[model samples]
Target: MSDLGLDDLAAELADFAPAKKKQATYTAREERIIAGFEDIERFYEEHGRLPQHGEDRDIFERLHAVRLDRLRELEDCRTLLAGLDKHALLDRAAVVSMDEDDLDPDDLMAELSGLGEGDDITTLRHVRSAEEKRAAEEVARRDKCHDFEKFEPLFKQVKDDLANGSRITRPFELKAEIRPGAFFIVFGQICYVAEMGEVFTNPQGRTDARLRVIFDNKTESGMLMRSLQRQLNEDDAGRRITDPAPGPLFADKADDGEAETGTIYVLRSKSDHPVVAEHREVMHKIGVTSGSVEARISGAEKSSTYLLAGVEIVATYKVYGVNCQKLESLMHKVFASAQINLSIPDRFGHMVKPREWFLVPLHVVDEAVERIRDRSILDWVYDPNAGRLVEA
Candidate 1:
């Protein structure tokens, strides 16, 4: 039997064995879904945290947040990526609240059906995933600003305000923040929201409006309100240039927008003092007053409190509900670690020590104001070495 023809035995065994099974290969569409999730993995690896969802978050991060949310919820995705979840990615909190209303409904439908782009019955046209659709939409459409002359001045003023710290920049947060007359820095360019068209709901049941945004370069864009929000959130340096803060918001008999009682001003000295000259970028005098900032500093050079020199106003914040003095005190206490020590002679020649001037940067002052506004300054303190605010 062993000697019996080898070819005949092989043929019998080939017919007897079960047909050789082919190894599973993913479709292009399936590959894409995993690829998108892989991006989140890479982000987590780079950042050491799962992507969290919010309009205030970066655009790509938000997309990753949405993608991660799906990975946690979808059975197919969880199963396919179960082996690759070395970081327990799929097990993290999937409760990230995302505004999925604006997202294309077809995305969810295709995901649920577990079908590839090639499985379409009617048309062989390629179907794009939600990420692709969004990536394509990221390219903002710019048009010629017919009356760029009018907006050119506003842009110049904002740049000047930003430069002098009269106006400060904050992270871009929402679509609602993009109303007419608002100024934003997107991709390092000044984006002035000139006019807003009528609000309308798209087919996706999301509120939207068209905006006439004028850029710094005399170029303009007719981008949607949400599109600008997306662009700003996606950009690392995108920021909103705040309007000059209004006075105290808690004043009695105050009409809307008339409640501001005072402004907080930051001043840089023109002193010939060695320390002041050496650390000019980080030195600042912080104070609050119920009158005009210009009027407050009218006789700065004669006062030792002003470092015995003319002072340049660098930043200002308007107070609303809180007392200007109290808010000023709060900021001083928080930045106590970075307080500047300056002993100067008054007009009478007696030495005087100034207390309000600090050894912190302008951006740190901006953060303090934000903390004061949010009522969180009490829980934090300034770290001069790190040059940032940290938990107290």
Candidate 2:
């Protein structure tokens, strides 16, 4: 009775000792409350004031204010946040409940419908007109351009081409289907259809498509095919933009007294000037004519259009009944960025700007002509950096 064994002593200690408690894990609701409280604490620390609500208040602050209201109403949340109320935010006046008098009907509806949470309830609204429905569909289909920079320069060039008469705008045809990579002018703004959506029927039972319409001003819009069609029809100024033609200029007589076919010609300057010599390989004039190249360059030293320099015909390609003038303009437009800004004195002793000369290689001119022939030049550009033609 006086001395206890080791087993008996251990049993006595175990029975007298307190039970160990399990570690606590936060529930999803508790975690949300903790996060919300932390956000409020951060806001208070930064601004030295609690978040407030109203239309005049910032969106984030309004959200925080709403969150605070919800937290204050929940007993569990208040208990969890009791220790975090170092800013005395919990002791502040309760959030006033918004009634019909305090909020717009639409806002009240939006709040009750959980529309802000990304729930699709578009059908709850009144029936939309054909145009309105199409517009809404376009808005829902909006996408961001990940590589807009790659296309920005191309868009700029197209605008320039349009302004300088290198590209032409014709009436948009009703029969022509809207397709990706097609260019159109709507409300006097040049719109490029960079992307297209799936085929579907509009409320009017007409086939329609959604298009990513990029404008020359760098602004973009998602629009419906029918909507755009209606715009083009209604806005008499709308037009379908066409690529540069630059086919041929002057014509020569054939044996049958008919105009002979044209040629896309590249000519190299024989000038001894510094700029001309420095860029000799790339400095050339591109032109399209149905007449002889020799005749075209004849007396070139007298004309400012030839930079008052004699030009030797470097390359030439024959073509049939295409618009040579349009083709020449197309070549000029293709190499517009590289065009040599040379001002030379004409026979009249007045300085004149020669627009046809470009600081581009002969091979590029050949490729451009080939592309123009195949009607593929509209989709490609001469990348001076790569020294080759690339798809736009």
Candidate 3:
């Protein structure tokens, strides 16, 4: 089949190249849905659990929890994000099975407040839905981290340190020092302070500095130190990750009224008693200790302070630059409504009353800790019926 022009054709084929492929396009709604789900994934990775819905939960977690619910309901959303569900978050959700037994269109229509018919609904003229409002505050808070590669390894190491207990998280103290190279957990994300700018007097005559903060979700914020302080004080779960040795928060030396004390430990009673068994999910013994918690509770079952029950260490919070006794008293007063009322008899037939036991949920306890950090616990009281800390 060779021809006179075969040599020329072979030369042209040698330089043949295909055109570059164009990037795929996605609708904004689709993109936002994926972005929202990714937050849930990051939450799972950092905390090793799915984001939960509760008034007591962090705002970011609450958003993710709501987003997860919506994703599970929409087949298209699940299909779109199927490839990225490495944690089977969606798969586990299916088993929960949100059953809709009532065949009432009127009830269904009542819940779809912002939904409208036809393409007009897609226009910006529509009011923001309640779900959007819940997440809108933070959805666009940070820009994409273009230089994420430079900080990814640091994130990995911090995560490892947390897993091994080398790094610890405590409530972000009010007016707490925010400097470069510090790690923090804020709004359900790992935030790294990459750089700190020159300190300048703010409008309120308070010292403030601009920060280059990078989030583990591949987002960055050029935020101010005072703004972060205010945010952390307001946020129920905002925490600072302490350094490995001689931590910035817990140093060898502390100034007046800022002494590094002990830790706040939450223990779950393992007692087989009816009262303890009934409220075990929410029952926790809150205490402060300067010594090791393990050593403190070694023979917990033998003591009336522990309700003559073996205890499981549920959580520990490192207290820094604060009076432990005052902190412990503040928490007890905050959760006074949920305080356990019992008169269990000891082995010697002596009636014992456990004062530190609280019927409040763990997350609420966490919120209490946040309030204590900023001394806002003074104005807040635990509402047992509502299961949250409310204005006193």
> Which candidate should be chosen as best, given TM-score against the real structure?
3
lDDT by candidate, in order shown: 0.67, 0.61, 0.66
Better of 1 and 3 by TM-score: 3
- Worst 10-residue stretch by lDDT in candidate 3? 98-107
Q: Model 1: C-alpha RMSD to truth?
A: 19.9
Name the lDDT value of residue 24 in candidate 3: 64
For candidate 1, write residues 111-186 as lDDT tens digits. Answer: 1111223332111122234433343343224556778878878866775554333565666777778899999866
Q: In model 1, how many backbone clashes occur?
A: 6
Residue 3 of model 3 has an lDDT of 65
- Clash counts for all predictions: 6, 14, 0
1-94 in candidate 2: lDDT tens per residue? 6788999899989978889888767654364356557777777897877786543244345556766766676676677778767877877873
